[model samples]
Target: MEKNDFLCPHCRGHLRPNNKIILSARTPDNKVGLILLSPELGEYSVVKHDSFKIKEGEHIDIFCPVCHADLGTYHENKNLAKIIMIDEKGIESDIVFSEIAGQKSTCKIHGDQIEDFGEDASIYTNLWGATPKY
Candidate 1:
């Protein structure tokens, strides 16, 4: 949602919510989708039909569209990305998602453990359609 603003860890540039998720594999061919979670509206929404693509068997590196910082990347079928998450309180954290463990998110500001739901969780979960969008 627009309620939580995502800032780049390296440059502090505002990371806008991307309705499109693009997945690129080692090969050139990629898969795309437009579905996403709108923290603004607090529900699921479809952005565009032509974007948010995902490769079937490729590891993905999610990046900031503004500053182009490497946010996080998930391994093939791992469902985890080492991305930064900013909460409604403006606290920043590193979020790692996993199929077995659900999500392990830690605040970069205080190096404290972060909760896994509510406004804070949106940062790690709403990545267009790129698998585990966190």
Candidate 2:
């Protein structure tokens, strides 16, 4: 989805779907990692090379879809979303309302959490995971 389509349903706040959903590895020692999931294909794509550099006690910005409210920050590793997935045939599928693992707030306008992974996330994930020729 385009950026214009991203309006908080509650406060109507604008949300930019960030292609990079940062994560920190829990097991095998504390290390940062990036899992590029194709939002369009709905599957894991590739792992990033660089480790995510985050400061302690830092909160990232999470937007609410229903009300456009700014849900406060969360731990890096706790924010996991199955934004994309892939089938056996290598066809990509976008999951619009996939469950996000670490969402911990409600929307200001609608008083609900943002459940839908917006179109920007979908398109970004697809482009990131797409083959070079495509």
Query: What TM value does model 1 have?
Result: 0.43
* Regions of model 1 farther than 4 Å from truth: 17-37, 40-48, 55-58, 73-79, 97-110, 117-134
lDDT of 1: 0.40
- Model 1 residue 39 distance off true place after TM-score fit, in angstroms: 3.8
What lDDT score goes with residue 1 in model 1?
A: 34
Taking all chains together, each candidate's TM-score versus the true structure is: 0.43, 0.24
lDDT of 2 by residue, 1-134 (tens): 23112333335343334653322232223443433333233233434465554333344333454353433322233332222223345433322322242222211111121222333243233322342221
Where does the lowest 10-residue lDDT sum fall in candidate 1? 99-108
Task: Identify the runs in model 2 with alpha carbons over 4 angstroms from their true place.
Answer: 1-26, 50-134
Mark the 10 consecutive residues where model 2 has the least summed lDDT.
Answer: 105-114
- Top candidate when judged by lDDT against the true structure: 1
lDDT of 1 by residue, 17-93 (tens): 45322211221243422223233322323243454454343444445555665444333444444445566787666
